[model samples]
Target: MARSETESERLKRIAILNARLPRTRAIAQGVLRDPKGRVLLCELSYKREWDLPGGVVDPGESPATCVEREIFEELGLSVTVGRLLAVNWLPPWRGWDDALLYLFDLGVHHAGELDPALYLRREIAGAHWRSIADAAAHVAPYTARMLEVAADAEHPLYLENSEPGRTR
Candidate 1:
């Protein structure tokens, strides 16, 4: 004779299995350029380096949708997220767990549309438009590498630690 599983036991088993799975964090960032060919970067209040406009991806949200949502929430700019440019796997850093960063194209707009005075979120200290070379100097090293490739990529790429040819 076989014993039937109780609801309590089934719930405990599911909880245990879920806890054992990999739980890497996910981030969605957008690359919005101005007519002058400068990428829009955010000066985050908490970090020294300026970064592309975006935020962490909430659970169950698609990366494309996450980028669109993040751009509006963080900068108060409603943007239509374009094709995914790259999927970069980031290693753990500065006490945060490993994460996958999805980079999407936010399309170009006139520079005047992102005035600092219009900022809606306190997390953003300001917004800057920088050329690829200039942005590389101010953003994180990983971000710099990602920009180097993703900026000119005609198709999507998979990067590891923001470096090409390392995807696994």
Candidate 2:
């Protein structure tokens, strides 16, 4: 005869899984700067905090692809994502365990109209190009470091193992 599993045990397993999900959520962030040298910032609905324009890497999506897709969806513009910037390892916040953030240098070109249609598509309450220093002061510390690197155009940001070359 075999022993049967209990409902309590099943519930415990689900609880464990739920706790682990956030731990595995890896994010890709971008520090996009327009030609005028202002960095783009977005106001998230969750914290209502201003942040750099970037998001998580979807299942089977490359970091570059994620960044570009985020740009079009959020800003309503076709963008050229440049060199890799910094890799931030965020320990769990708000009951999450772990997160890996890949920061990239994004180049914005005025390629579309910023109007109601685009604004209504995303949860972006506002979109604006702010001075790097000003943007840095408003976002999280990890993002602040990203802006610090991006502000210095002479010193291009690169990932840990990426070779010397601009992505696009």
CA lDDT, every model vs. true structure: 0.88, 0.66
Question: Candidate 1 at residue 63, lDDT?
Answer: 83
lDDT of 2: 0.66
Question: Lowest lDDT 10-mer window, candidate 2?
Answer: 156-165
TM-score of 1: 0.89
True-structure RMSD for candidate 2: 7.9
The list of candidate 2 runs beyond 4 A from truth reads 1-23, 110-113, 120-122, 150-168
Clashes of each: 0, 0
How far is each candidate from the true structure, as Cα RMSD in Å?
2.4, 7.9
Alpha-carbon deviation at 117 in model 2, angstroms: 3.4
Best by lDDT: 1
Model 2: per-residue Cα lDDT at residue 96: 65
List TM-scores for all candidates, in order.
0.89, 0.67
Model 1 Cα displacement at 133 (Å)?
0.8
Best by TM-score: 1
What residue runs in model 1 are displaced by over 4 Å at the alpha carbon? 1-12, 166-168
